[model samples]
Target: MTDHPRSGAHDRLVTSLGTSIVTGELPPDSDVDPVALESQFGVSRTAVREALRVLSAKGLVGARPRRGTFVAPREQWALLDPDVLRWRFADRVDGVFLDELGEVRLTVEPTAARLAASRRTDRDLADLEDALAAMRSAGEKDADEQVTADLAFHDALLRAAHNELLLQMSVVIEVGLRLRDQFVHGALTTESADKHAEVLLAVRKQRPKAAETAMRALIEKSIADVEIAKKAI
Candidate 1:
């Protein structure tokens, strides 16, 4: 646990450094000057050290016996950690990263949708409908709201699956989905509500095959949408 009194400073320092490392502002294997960090972030030495500890736990940095702490290789990063994923999505839109995220979604979501259709409870259905309603209400007029609602719909879908492992995986998946949604927000030429509705309809009807198919199509559209958005960027 961190010092309660210095929590704010600790958090700020961690955020700044984490974002820099993930965005390549502080590229892999670069030296990390803790004394410089204390000066730059205007935090106590203790706060700086504590922040470094947090990043270390996230696999963002490591110390050499003679050389002090340095940014770790990119492959060493805890990519599934929510904070790391958030930092990666904080700035810069990389098409390759988005494609990889889509591939992950393809691997996870269709199977989740199939299970949800087979096992969803009344409460799960209610939550999904509520999320879908919010999505419809937001439409294209409100990009931020649409993104939030879209995320909620997926979260509810995962919950509907009623599997502990998939639920755990949703933590990472949600972050990637938000990035994709935000990236394609204003650039999307087609209405996404209908596609989401198709998946919802299948789940509601307890059609596993249909739900799986609809989810696959939805994810495919998202992949294509990201590609289109990248071109506009």
Candidate 2:
């Protein structure tokens, strides 16, 4: 994303500040020291300000008259923002957050699968099949590819549901999914592929109830994988 010196500085400042804030090093309502940031990061004042503005837009920081800029309360943060999610999971998986993400997936994915069964088109089926095939072909050495394909499969399933709001919700879900995959990718087995296959098959067969059940099982398996991976870590 950073292609130039100035942008790189801005990004570095943002990433540093954001990580600090997310990790509670700069706890809520703490002052954001632009001068210190500029000196510490060797970034220009413009770069520092620009980074602050970006964080502000993401609800990570806010300014008040006579008070300068400060980190916002957690409730004010855009938790679903990709940057925030990345920061949260960048160093290590937050078990609580990961469990919360799993809960969301459990609640939404099964219903999404049911709708997909009734709404999916031939193209949707093809896309799901492609993603499934990618998953199956991804061996232990192909962790990155496995993650991408796994994400693609869920994305295809969401699209198959034909709901605009659900599609938008995937924006948030995708971030957590990627992080979880990074941790659990090594734990994937033929059974994992088989579970996804079950969902795909149900969608392909247009069996709403079966699709729902399969998706629930798939997500449950994913949650179990994360639990296992967390212990391994």
Query: Could you give candidate 1's per-residue lDDT for residues 150-189 as a string of tens digits?
Result: 8889999999999988887787777776677667766322
Q: TM-score for all predictions?
A: 0.90, 0.91
Alpha carbon deviation, residue 88, candidate 2 (Å): 1.4
Question: How large an RMSD does model 2 have?
Answer: 2.9
Give model 1 RMSD, 1 decimal: 2.2
lDDT of 2 by residue, 115-209 (tens): 99999999999999999999889955688888788889989999999998888768667887777766775755678889999999999999999
After superposing candidate 1 on the true structure, give the runs of residues whose Cα lies further than 4 Å from its correct spot.
1-6, 187-190
